[model samples]
Target: MELDGNALGGDLSSVFAADVTGAVFVCAGCQHSGVVASLRVWVPAPGLVGRCPNCTDVVLRLVRTPTRAFLTLTGASRLELPLD
Candidate 1:
């Protein structure tokens, strides 16, 4: 099943200093640009995986443990976060 990026709010907030749902992401694989909230998300995996809506490429991956949170955006060439 695929959930929208909004599902990542709480998890992402754990790692970022500000809300990132409105952040824009540019896919490295196809150069597709979109807001983070527009990505497709999967939750049943080892961690939360967010994919680009345009190219279906992996855009971001986030994993959280009791003491640590891991976030990777290797699939995204650029990320633009909203400033205040």
Candidate 2:
């Protein structure tokens, strides 16, 4: 199913040490840039797959295991974290 990126807020914050919903991501595939919150997230997969809103390219994937959470940035070329 399709969900907003905010669905992974707690998981993301724990991994980033800050809220990542406001962070801007530049997709390498189509060069689309937007906040993570605006990305489309697929939750049915084994991991949370976040895609670029404009290009629909997979930008990130977040998988949480019992011991650690693995985050893979697939097509995101640049990430601009918010300045508090």
Candidate 3:
């Protein structure tokens, strides 16, 4: 079964100051751009992973602990977020 980016809502909201599901993510590997909500997500991984829909490249990674959360966007060339 496949899951969409919305599955990361609780996890993402914990790290970002704003709702980032609507943010645009540009894939570094294929230069494909899409909304965060549109990315494919894998929650069963060691952590949460969001991948580009067009190229199947990882776009974002999130790992959370009891007191800390780590987010990496190495696969994303750019992330455009809404101002409001």
Candidate 4:
């Protein structure tokens, strides 16, 4: 199943002070840049994974538990968030 970055809005919001879905992510693997909303997402495993559309690099990962949420942004070289 494929989802978009918006699918992480609810869970990611819990950890981030800003809205993650509107943030722009730069792919570290291929230097591709795009908004999180445009990434190809896969949510079938224990976590949520968002990959780059241009290079298929994993840009976002979210793992949620009853007590904690683990987010990994290793595939992203930069993240630009909305000011307001």
Candidate 5:
């Protein structure tokens, strides 16, 4: 399923399912995307800290830190609406 920006908040367990090895966070504003390794850390929450691959913009990092499941999207400062 395509994850919309609005559906990003809350617990991210479902987003980082057991079978999901990783995920790519694509920026809606610039189409920048980044790959996140999902097996490295256990993500207690759904947020992270990084920059966009395409735009080099600071992203609101969403991560399952324990499993290393993570993604970086354009922050609310860069967008007009809340990401979730």
Candidate 6:
């Protein structure tokens, strides 16, 4: 999915393509420029938060959706799916 540029804290977000290769990239907010390993993505329970691998920054906040496939991020595009 295409991330909103305004949602990113800085230019680092620009480097991330919507079609992520599941490879974790370095966090621009921190000095640690090492490659992110073991990248994992999942829908978490209520109150759970997603964090950056390099700097442990809270990147995504989880929320409930009406459908199993609500959003799709692929090939530099963001697609919203209807509830099925």
Return the top candidate by TM-score. Answer: 1
TM of each candidate vs. truth: 0.95, 0.93, 0.94, 0.91, 0.33, 0.30
lDDT per residue for candidate 5 within 16-80, as digits (tens), equals 44322234554555764444321122233345344444564555566566666665444423332
| Candidate 5 vs candidate 6, TM-score winner | 5
lDDT of 1: 0.92
**Residue pairs in candidate 6 whose N, alpha carbon or C atoms collide under 3 angstroms:** 1-73, 1-74
Best by lDDT: 1
lDDT of 3 at 42: 71
Arranged by TM-score, best first: 1, 3, 2, 4, 5, 6
**lDDT of each model, Cα atoms only?**
0.92, 0.89, 0.90, 0.87, 0.42, 0.32
Indicate the TM-score of model 1.
Answer: 0.95
The runs of at least 3 residues in candidate 2 whose Cα sits more than 4 Å from the true structure, single-residue gaps closed, are none
Error of 5 at 31 (Å): 0.8
Worst 10 residues of 4 by lDDT: 1-10
Better of 3 and 5 by TM-score: 3
**What would the TM-score be for candidate 6 when compared with the true structure?**
0.30
**lDDT order of candidates, best first?**
1, 3, 2, 4, 5, 6
Model 5 scores a C-alpha lDDT of 0.42
The digit string of per-residue lDDT tens for model 6 on 1-84 reads 223223222222234434223333444345333222222233334422334554555444434345331222222112222232
- RMSD of every candidate to native, in Å, equals 0.8, 1.0, 0.9, 1.0, 10.5, 12.8
For residues 1-84, could you state the per-residue lDDT of candidate 4 as single tens digits?
887778878888899898888889999999998888888888688888889989898888889989989989999999999896
